[model samples]
Target: MSEFKMEHKNPEGLFVSKAFSQAITVSGKAKTIYIGGQNATNSKGELIGAGDLELQTKQALNNIATILASENASFANLVKLNIYLLSGCDPRIGYKAFQEVAGLLENPPLVTVLFVSEFARPACLLEIDGIAVIEDKD
Candidate 1:
């Protein structure tokens, strides 16, 4: 068993979403992992999807998953996610794509979706960044 604990909550007054948690309280010793913004790009830095929001969203989520694995963690370890969508993009597409992969997580993390005019890469449709906490081994 692990000493680290996390309490996820979605109060009655708040909008409860299957996609994400409203809040999370972390306790005990843990290691915090800060993941950088990831877009729909392959390991070779080439865009995976062009002019396709759903595909882009999935690729970005896959990138995040890869990062989490590198830290000896998974989606369940995520505490928060900041999602940036192109200003004119449809968020529903992104949400659906996320759900396809996020269904594996028993406790999804708190999420914030924002509309941005542009990203560092012009071809990028969306970007995702995450923060995760893992039980401290050291």
Candidate 2:
């Protein structure tokens, strides 16, 4: 089992994800895996469910999943999730997506959601960036 902790907190945090914040202080392997910002697109680079935040959110997550799988990682190995929204995503949407992702695994990773002005792809209603750690299957 891995241990998680909270090393610091932002002074003006309005709604910091307690779970995610605590993960910042976790003690684990010196080695870590980083996932770049994954937009709402498929491996084929096709836009997914354009103009729909929920659909885009799902596709972006799918993209993230693929990335993890490629590295022998799973959502259970996820320590943090950083979400970027292009607007229209209320707290409810965030919560719902969290549930959806959690539902995909036996153990879900902590998450943080931040609203952004825009994404590189205009059709991207949402994006996800995160980190996952897995025991190297040597």
Candidate 3:
């Protein structure tokens, strides 16, 4: 059995959705993973969605998923997500794309979205970083 306990919450007066939780509480002995900001770059370090916010968001999320998989973890173990978007990018576009992927998880993680002027790569439209908690096997 896993030693991790995670709870998602959307308190009164807060909007709710399968794609995200307003708050997340985690307890018990677990291994926490902090993932760096993932961009819309492919394995060859080339940008995937140059000027499309939605497409870039999807690619960034996919990158994060691939990184998590390397550690034997999945979106189900994610507790928090921080999304960064290009200053002029529409957040709704990114949100829609994110929902398409995050909705696959049984419980969504808490999230914060921010708009920034630029990124490490000029063509990057967005980036996503995450924190995940997995049961300690040892």
Candidate 4:
């Protein structure tokens, strides 16, 4: 199988930042992984953080990590991420936590953030989902 290539770009007229890419193009043989929404829920199905956006965001990111690892992938394989926070919540807290946990990637994935009025779980402060791609070794 041929190697997969991921090209991260920030076009000339667009704003660029270390936090995320404006766009990413993947080519060649690859396996795509779609991660479902994850919150602060732990392995035991118990909420890990309540009323704390930072902790909740970190736990959600960690949950995503576990899912990625199960498929032999990591944060480096991620191409896109969607984060949702409860309305009226401070996003800076969530962003800070994500940086602390996920750290900085050489090629960070494209990210989208939205504010919602509520979540399925009232105690939940945030949720995250992601898409990743990896070379097909087959």
Candidate 5:
């Protein structure tokens, strides 16, 4: 596992715990893996969380994690993350979910959570996509 740590240069920053700099930069040669939008459902095609942003966010992360694992990637290896959210929500609601999701990762990845008018199916409060790069370890 890579030694992933959060940087806190601006201690008085507004979003203190919610800000970070990505660990992996252009300096290293890493393998790339792109994970598609993952929602709060599992392989069984059932919704893990209903009508709840926090629960759904957790499930979405788990769903994304599975995809990453299949490709030999971990949150620590993530270079970018894209979060897609259903329309009928306060932006703060999505931000809250995102804050939790970021905390779950070993290190915060470059992220942009977009609020969309609709998703593949409704009732999904959040969907997450990930791009990761792991060193060759050679």
Candidate 6:
């Protein structure tokens, strides 16, 4: 059995949808994991998507998913996500990819997307970081 309980809510005046929740509350004995910004780099450290925002977003989210899996968690355990996109990239492109990959979760986590002029790697078009809560069933 899981050791944590999650409640996702859209406040009285807020819009509702499977894409995301206005807020997510987590309770119980849980372990929190802070994931650093992930980019479109493969295991060999090669950039997966150079000028494509959608591809980069997908790769970055894939990286985060891998990290979450390492701790026995999945997108369902995510409480928050922070996305960074290159200035010229259309936010819609990245968001569309995100929803396709993350919208399947029973409770999508809160998200904050930002536009930045550049990143550590010039070729990087998008990056994503997140926080997840795992039920410590010990």
lDDT of each: 0.90, 0.68, 0.85, 0.91, 0.69, 0.87
lDDT string, candidate 2, 31-116, tens digits: 36799998878878899888666677777777887888888766666778888887666656655665686564444456777888
Q: Which candidate is the best by lDDT?
A: 4
How high a TM-score does candidate 3 get?
0.89
Q: Where does candidate 1 clash, by residue pair?
A: none
Off by over 4 Å in 5: 1-17, 22-24, 90-106
Per-residue error for 37 in candidate 5, Å, reads 0.4
How many clashes (backbone atoms < 3 Å, residues ≥3 apart in a chain or on different chains) does model 3 have?
Answer: 0
Count of clashes, each model: 0, 1, 0, 0, 0, 0
Error of 1 at 9 (Å): 1.1
Which digits, one per residue and each the tens of the lDDT, describe model 4 over residues 1-138? Answer: 367898999999999898899999999989999999999999999998778888898899999999999889999899999989899999889878878987888889999999999999999989999999989887
Cα lDDT for residue 107, candidate 3? 83
Top-TM-score structure, candidate number: 4
Q: What is the C-alpha RMSD of each candidate to the true structure, in Å?
A: 1.2, 4.8, 1.7, 1.2, 4.5, 1.6
Model 1, 41: alpha-carbon shift in Å?
1.2
| Candidate that beats the other on TM-score, 1 or 3, i.e. the better one | 1
Native-to-model Cα distance after best TM-score fit, residue 81 in candidate 4, in Å: 0.7
* Residues 1-138 of candidate 5: C-alpha lDDT, one tens digit per residue: 544333323234435334344333533455678888888887899987788877888788877778778878767667777888777666566556656654555456777768788766677888888887766555
Question: How big is the positional error of residue 3 in model 3, measured in Å on the Cα after superposition?
Answer: 2.7
Query: Ranking under lDDT, best-scoring first?
Result: 4, 1, 6, 3, 5, 2
* Candidate with more favorable, higher TM-score: 2 or 3: 3
Cα lDDT of model 3 by residue, 1-138, tens digit: 666788888899999877789888888888889999899898998888788887788888888889888888888889999998888888889878877876666688888988899887888988889899887777
Per-model TM-score, in order, reads 0.94, 0.72, 0.89, 0.96, 0.71, 0.91
Compared with the true structure, what per-residue lDDT tens digits does model 1 show for residues 1-138? Answer: 788999999988998877889999999989999999999999998899899999999999999989899989988899999999999999989989988976646788999999999988999999999899999999
Q: How close is candidate 1 to the true structure, as a TM-score?
A: 0.94
The TM-score that candidate 2 achieves is: 0.72
Tell me the tens digit of each residue's lDDT in model 6 across 38-90. 99998899999778888888889889989999999889889998988888788
The true-versus-predicted C-alpha distance at residue 42 of model 4, in Å, is: 0.2
